[model samples]
Target: DIYAYGSTFRGGEVGVVIVNSGSSAHEISIGGLAVAVKAMGWLVTSNETSSSDPLSARGVMWNGQSSPQSFPLLSLGAYSASLSDDGVLIELPPYSAAGLVVYF
Candidate 1:
């Protein structure tokens, strides 16, 4: 289970995802939607066929009949999927992007 006990915000839209690498379902909690750390679950899938696919090459992934993949998979970014206020994003310091994950 993943629990967030701090504050998080974005000057622009932000996407957050939480994955359960364990064999069983995990629990998650955030303080709030705006200030709380956002989280979501990503189902484990088979080997990726495209660079755009979620087939993370970081670790050994189940080929539909194997074990779990390693952390840090190849996923799309939120900015590429969502059209946001250009000014809002452009004005943010580079550190902002470092802190947030742009999920699709």
Candidate 2:
């Protein structure tokens, strides 16, 4: 139901990406990040949260493969849902310590 707009299976470079899990807690990649969300049957914009970072950011997720606690990445498209740490960061995070990053 929720996946990268372009192609979930081959999310190569359609301007959209997925938030899958990884080995470490901080697994997702946040560089050149962007997101799209559909909530309450309504649409959201990634204007404020959307950033064209050349350095690369990261997100933190407790549930990526299982559970419904994947709050950081609520959907996949071009909107933003309270963007968090995606993994692959130069510095460590000070948040909850439970981050599931997806390198896109």
What's the lDDT for residue 11 in model 2?
A: 40
Residue-level lDDT tens digits of model 1 in 19-90: 333233333332223332332222233343333433343423322223444434444322322323331121
**Each candidate's TM vs. the true structure?**
0.25, 0.17
Compared with the true structure, the alpha-carbon lDDT of candidate 1 equals 0.30
| Regions of candidate 1 where Cα sits further than 4 Å from its true position | 1-11, 34-104
Tell me the number of clashing residue pairs for each predicted model.
2, 20
Residues 1-104, model 2: lDDT tens digits: 12233223354322333322222223234344444221111122222223353113343222222223445545532222343344133212222122222323
**Model 2, clash count?**
20
Q: How close is candidate 1 to the true structure, as a TM-score?
A: 0.25
lDDT of each: 0.30, 0.29
